[model samples]
Target: MGGAPERADGCGARVRGRSAGSGRLSVTARTRGWRDRAAAELAAAALATREETVGDVLVVGDRTGVLARALGDRGAAVHRWGRRLGEGEVVSAWPPDGTVVLSAVRLPRSRAELAFAVHAAAARTRPGGTIAVYGANDEGIRSADRALAAVAENVTTLRVGGHCRVVAGRRSEAHADGGPDVFAIDFELSADDWGSQRLRGCGGRYRTWPGVFGGAGLDAGTRALVRVMAGFDRSPERVLDFGCGWGPLARAARALWPDARVEALDVDALAVRAVAANAPGVEARLGDRVEGAACYDLIVANPPYHDGKEEDTRVIEALFSDGAGALREGGCMVLVVQRRLPVPRLAAARFRRARPLADEGIYRVWELVGPL
Candidate 1:
């Protein structure tokens, strides 16, 4: 209806064809189910009219397996950025002009995440272009509507259906500041301060404010893993900090093995940025997987086990699988987790060997490795 037309695919599902310019469209989704629902809705809208022209479509956020499955019915170029997109993270650079940008994001629980969502929504929409956001009732959909209205030129709650509400807005001017408190802050980490830093179990203190992992204090799982890590031969030339939160493990690893080059990867862009700020010397990248062919001698992670508000293990599985593939022969993946999680079972199937290295009463360090 917005000048875009939908065309029918051979699979009988309606798919939107490309539009003018780059003909690229962007859909930011929350979970796998939501992604499927949104894609179906968009596909239906696109096929009924067959007028919307889109060359490429990019879906950003978690449970991309669902996004891939939903897009499977359509014959179009599709790419995905996996779980937990941070502030200002855009899956594609497709301009908002004459584009259909759909966001199925949950309400932000923290002020930092809220600011990030606002900025992300604004960046995806062009002047006078429409952006749609859908969320469940309890996720503060109403509050989200209010917040969007305050920032955008025209905002409206388009629909509320299936226990979910859709809010649409258009930005005619620059985004009003989400307020100074939510703005990014500068973080400095130094050896001088490291001596006093108290990050989880690391006796040396590290400075990290809110929004960073283990920001409030150290989690029990990380503290347990750090203690057991000392028992392993720590002299590896290459190491990977999968799901490195706030650079605590990176900081500890770097201190123990000064000669090793450590690579930190996290799904949260904000976390990645924060880690970089706190550990300038440590190589950190924002992404879902371990990038590059250089296998690490050691891979450590406390992979995320939650999605939005529910307990989900998809992200953790992805990291564990990737870590196994990214480790060199005889290299080890040291992971810490609550004993209740079936991580050992998951690891046993994925790794050549998996066993508990140490149990700290609450958490256990699961070590998986190639033929030891």
Candidate 2:
């Protein structure tokens, strides 16, 4: 478990990891459940493709292993890029132009995210080169095609299997990116004694691009958590925003305690960029988990619950599991979660002490004290 782990063809082999293009085969986590089904469908569609010549393949999004393998089997050099970057992909500093980009787009995401995919793919594609997006019908693949049409031409259905479909389009010469501004979206948030409301107007003051949790605006639960966090008497010296969305909590912490060293981390690239651009002083990191988050006075979190359509608490559990080791003797981990979530109970199981600081509307803020 060093460098980066890659999921092999099957069998869920994850202990040993291999470098990207060493021609070395790595054991990949077995694709099961919905993921397995989606990959099979997408791979089939990519295989059936003969309408356009594919020289290079660039894949984005989840279910990448099977699809990457399938495209590679078709004799195209495959490069995997997206949120899931480390899983046996020829990682790149930036995507190459004139290449075919395949994306496994999830069904639920902001319009801005879809637009970014369309624009990004087009920017890297040469004229007559194709870009294909695959997802379940529930994921709004057809609607996404409409957005794709904005950046590419000849947009049409490539294939359909089960409840999933693949949409492909060729980037035309007419499309030339003036700038990255076309991907920007406005987030307007209002204050109600809850944090700063994050975004105040549609002037595009916020640095959000796409696909970030709570980047659209402040979540009600997060706002509630912030309100209670502000009421606390002690001023923390060092703060960590675990799963920080747009650096709202981290920014608020910095404003509250100017001397405090606030840091923000997220799994999304857009979020990391947003925080770095919008929140001046905080350290921004793009990563999947908190590994060496040590000796922080306060760790704030509003962890995500779903990976696309699958609902799970694995991430929340990890945050709590790591809390016991990451904090100082008298430090705190403050989590804002929906009323129905079992975060309080989860915290209690890990820390032996969990305090319900505030409960407002559908959100509750829990303060879990770390052990000495």
Candidate 3:
């Protein structure tokens, strides 16, 4: 961590190296503090326990590229899988034969997500190669050994510190068949739930993997939002589905406004791929932020409220602010959320006016007009 600041490492994570001719230090930029704890612990554990040089490595769920940069500095060729495009390669499915010498995973929030990551790592690692998983104890690092045991052997604790733990296991030669595909769950959305006359025959099939919100089916909030869209008097020429999960809003928007150009944006790579598969013809972009001010005619969203297992309002707030900025002068943004959240207040903070559209007891829809 001690060195002059260097240029960004293409993945948006900053890298620090020695000045001029001096040799580089092992520490990379500590941009994400506590969020990088598990990654730091895994890097330390891997570097210490391995008898030989760290060879080809695969890092998963290291959102900030903490482990990837650290391992790369130690002479390991690192490959990273992440949610956003700039973070790493956003692959829907890892190649079956892309085996590596070592793989490090930062445990995800959902158990299904954790299982998918661990199984993928194990399958892609060479027989007897190392698979290391780490996370905070409260975030379910305690179950790392059990999850790895399904696809690996000789599971053991590697390191424990800073309320985080790293567990390692040898990739079992028997599980070379590869892990579950990214599109692991398939479900159909009924036209009746949409409540739109235009969408009566547009019922479509959708595929989703673990971790994406509303993966099981169309959630009640999104359904309510779509219903509200059906009643709009004006047909928007351009539509943006911000935080589009599986592209339900984008699909409905396309069906309702046939001539409108529809776009979908999401941070998750799997979610972006699902949108492409489920809502064909729409532009699905893998990004963490909304681009272009005053570019969209209509924006629809069901912004996420959680940063993991913990409920955080910053996600929704940022979406509101950005969506407002992305709308045209005559455009509006529609949103749905749990009634308990402060949607009206959040909208008022960014838009000139906030109008209530529908309230289904548990979920409420709002229309925000004219960015301030």
Candidate 4:
């Protein structure tokens, strides 16, 4: 009663009262059907609890749409990044510099990703505007305060609940010019590592944005897949690199079959952009499924097994199903997966003929012919 007032709505939700002077909702109560276990819910609650009023808010990496909806309901002008926005909503790669008053980030898994998100948010936020970074404590939210300090000042914890916490700070004018290029990394795959002198000749230099898989370096699994591809006796006319992270596979495919029309498809926007930047002329598409069934003469993939922090095979399995549908008659699909995964079993269930192409100890490459 001494602090901001509280009230219960007709629906039995205990909504936190707004400050009379600020006109900002102090906190949002958990509504029926809202899950406390979700990090998104905790982030929304934390934003509501902040003392500052939310105005012209930008929510980043909100895959679930929870934060955007909550802030909008509280009368904040909400813009979004990371996922597709609703129809009639403003959609851009990022908001214009110094236009946003507040930014809420759903902390990414990797530190490099965290740095990129924070820097971008700081760039978009007006001087002295707020940036709130939130995530589950188990997912490294504790280090968020330090991450924010790179581009912000007066950093402090805003709220803690549901095994999650939100840390916020005021964006510093000194770091307002930060952009994606601040975290972009350039590296090259050595000829020996790729096992192809031709691919090396095609230019090994590649660039990757933070948070893209295999951005730090080309992973061993992908390298193994590339070596196996180099051994193929026949050339493919139309190749699709499914789940092409940073377009390494697409790049290799292009080099091996110079005349082939190579395309890269990934679900991540950053990954798509990376493909465009790193592998010029390779068609990069952003989506989960392959378009135009039976159009591809070859489909190559090192499918993702993990969904966030958890190891989920369903992602690769779905890719297998989609790739199979996209392959033409006599076309082949090649995949590289960790040895611990049951790729043989999974591939057998989806393809008429699945055989081991290579066994590189920790990683295995499989070549499947005839889509069943």
Tens-digit lDDT track for model 1 on 1-372?
112333332211112222112442211123235533543354333232221113233333323333333443455333333224321223221223223333333345554554455555555444554444445565566667666664465677766665556665666576543422354554444443333233323443344433556664457777677666655655888887877867777767776677898778664555666566656577876455453333788888887776556677876776665567667777888988878889767776568888888787778788888632
Q: Which structure among the candidates has the greatest TM-score? A: 4
The alpha-carbon lDDT assigned to residue 180 of candidate 2 equals 47
TM-score of every candidate: 0.65, 0.82, 0.83, 0.84
> Model 2, which residues run further than 4 Å from truth?
1-40, 48-54, 83-108, 186-204
Q: lDDT, candidate 2, residue 125? A: 68
Model 3 Cα shift for residue 26 (angstroms): 24
lDDT of each residue in 1-372, candidate 2, tens digit only: 013344331210112233245552321222224744574466456553653325665665534366766666677666555542333333222233444534333333556677776666666666777767766777676677888788778888867777777777777788775444555555644444344443222123456666667756777887787777677788888888877777778767776777998878675556776787667898876544454445678888888766556666777887787666677768888888877887767776668578788887888788888653
Scored by CA lDDT, what does every candidate get? 0.54, 0.62, 0.71, 0.71
For candidate 3, give the lDDT of residue 304: 77
Worst 10 residues of 3 by lDDT: 11-20
Output the better candidate (1/2) by TM-score: 2
Candidate 3 stretches with Cα past 4 Å from truth are: 1-39, 46-49, 85-98, 177-183
Q: Which 10-residue window in model 2 sums to the lowest lDDT?
A: 9-18
Write one digit per residue (lDDT tens) for candidate 4, span 294-369: 7788988888776556666765776676677778888988889888888768877778988888888799898888
